[model samples]
Target: MSGRVMPGHTSDLLTLQDAGALWAGLTADSAVPTASTILISSLGSAQMSYALLGSHVVMAVKAHDGRWSISESEVRRAAVGLRAVKVDPQDLVRIGPFGGMPKGEHSEAVLLGWRRRIVGELQRPDPPEQVVPDGDDRALHLAGIDWRRILTEQSRDRTRQTWWLPRAVVRLLDAAEHVERRWLQAGQKESKAAEGIRPRSPRSQTHTTENLQVTKPDHLAASLRPYNEELKGLLYSVLSRKPDTSRKVTGWICTLCRKVPATVLDHCHEHGYVRAPLCQSCNAQERPDHLYPNDIRVTDRYTRLLTTHATEWLRHWHRCPGCRTRTTLPLSHLAAWTAYVACRPLRPTHRDNHSSRGRKPCGTLRVAWTGSHHTPHTCQLTVTIDLCPSGEHRDLAKVPYRQATEQFRIWLAKTAPTVAAAAGPDRLDDLPAQFRPVIPDKSDKGLGLF
Candidate 1:
């Protein structure tokens, strides 16, 4: 005999773990909980009305010996109290009907009404013929008594007093109301005036006409004309002049013939044209005569010779192809060579001895004098053929004498003006003819003479 299942008993049974698992699987098909009422039997009582509310089971049950109990927690968990309380719209009533004063549209109206009532009551005199009761009934329980006295008594002890309007107060009140009405009228007038005026939109024609009046391109070009002319003048000045004056010759010599101002260009066989200028006679001639690749031997020999002279003499003197003489020496070259020879072994001691004696080296020997004409007269001539330094004795190939002569003259003119003058006026004029003019014409083209 299986026990009959009560109406909402299924939820109660679900509180058991096994029954809950079964019920959850079954209820998964429904979104809303199944609604049903049930009867529960508990504590030896019967017909208990129960409901399933969300996750809890709520019930009205009978206890042992016929007592009823309602579970508050269970009822709350079931959401029974969640329904909103409602009053019928037809039953709505105003506070005035229930003893409150009639509502006014503004606070001033309400205040004015209260003030009138209080003033009227205060102005009324007490009835003279009325019987006077001297007990609590007359003082506290008098019928139709004035409440204003009571109000005044209560207000007398208060920190703040309530204001009562007399004739003066009524004047102030009238003034305030007049000011308020005037302000409201002024605000309404301003609002109406603002609504009457309209904002104007920008005119397209005016904007387009203004844009068209912009300055013309020709005016802008005219503004820049002065700057362009100035730039042009600067460029002409820079480009018209020769870039380097060192390439200009003031004299010439023929290295191969050992002659100054030789008629033939080939006599100076060691010189060669280098860029817009020419190379030193020795450098030009020896460059092509290298016995080793890249002219390394010749370059090394020249570098050593230049170093031996302390790089000073090489700056002013060039080797001659014909006599093998180092000629066209500048005035500074004399001091430089002297310093070089003095630095050599045994030379300084010889110079010191001569200086001490107040005499020069013997006349048979010739010592190079690079000073003024008076220099050679003051010094004794002495000749000494010492072996050149090992590093400076290498052989060099011969260069074109014409090119070498031209280069040497140019070098002399720029760096050794005194030596060039001493060589004679005609000697200075004997430089390559091409260098005498500003620009080479058709006849002077491609000769490699700048």
Candidate 2:
């Protein structure tokens, strides 16, 4: 069915069925549950945020206007009326964000087809990631000294100040050569002094001026590499904690940004290769050797928000139809979507008698032992079996157990891949691909959106 625009909200539209379902749901559950979506604003932008059930807004999934204005409060406030509608937990059509029902070609076949395809994809396991070595292996403790400071101070001490001076002298009995003539050259021989006046030899006259030749410092005689190792150890001791048995000790916490754990042992290439444990952000950048604080508050906030949103989404979508076991669901987006579709009630025309009658599903197949013969030469046992969807497909029940089992096996093969691909015990990978995690990227300093 084509979408029909709502009278007041002309920009958005919904099909007749979706509109009706929404109206029913809103009117049915008017009391706000903690999981209900809410309108929040920052800097004139309007966003819709969904929180987790039974929890405050620790996590959230958000949808926002592409543009904004100073009147964003008014825009968000207008949507406050829309908040009266809480999601119908049992409605399969009520998927995705509020008001995000599928639009055209709402055929049962199409829905089922999409569901099967998504389920198959979900079952496939994600490939493992390769870890590149980024940090130093040196172990550190608290009792280390700042060897760097001592080394610089020693270099400064090796420098000293020096100077040179020139002196004049005269020898007696050496007559002045035509110089004294300017003054009266009296017959009394100008005895300069007891020693005659004489010029000092050039070699003896000159003294060394300030020595400008470059010289290396003596303390630097020892390479600071050993000290750097010790410093690395000390930093690790102060900054990083020992990981639990299951977790490995990577490196220390980032000396630069306190937000992320240090993955690499970083050094100032400009200086004497001084090293410290640092996260990818500091190590990857063209920055100074010293650690500078990284402003990760924004990342931290958004992370909590997105995590809440995605998690609740999964819980809502993956709940089992019969038992409603949401906690056991695979946390993959594909799995969640598939589970939702599989739980959807089939149309009346498509449902079998058993399903229409609301009979709780027992074992899909029933087996009856026919007889057993205990002859010496031959002993044989036979059994009758029944498969489900009772009436029209009752012929399937008459098939031999072996054949029926084989058919069931085939169905398992088709469905197993997606179901088995669910989130593993360590849910680090449980977060959806849309999120840009802080630890994964070196350049993810700014707030990221999903």
Tell me, by lDDT, which candidate is best. 1
Report the C-alpha lDDT of model 2 over 116-195, residue by residue, as the tens digit: 22222223344578343342101110001111111111111245211110000000000110111111112122223212
Question: 330 in model 2: Cα distance from truth in Å?
Answer: 13
Clashes of each: 14, 16
Location of the lowest summed lDDT over 10 successive residues in candidate 1 = 90-99
Q: Write the per-residue lDDT of candidate 1 for residues 242-358, one digit (tens) a residue.
A: 544222211222222121111111112222211111222222222222122111121223333335432333432332111112243322222222223322332322233437675
Query: What C-alpha lDDT, on a 0 to 100 scale, does residue 236 get in candidate 2?
Result: 24
Q: Each candidate's TM vs. the true structure?
A: 0.14, 0.15
How much lDDT does each candidate structure score?
0.27, 0.23
* Candidate 2, number of clashes: 16
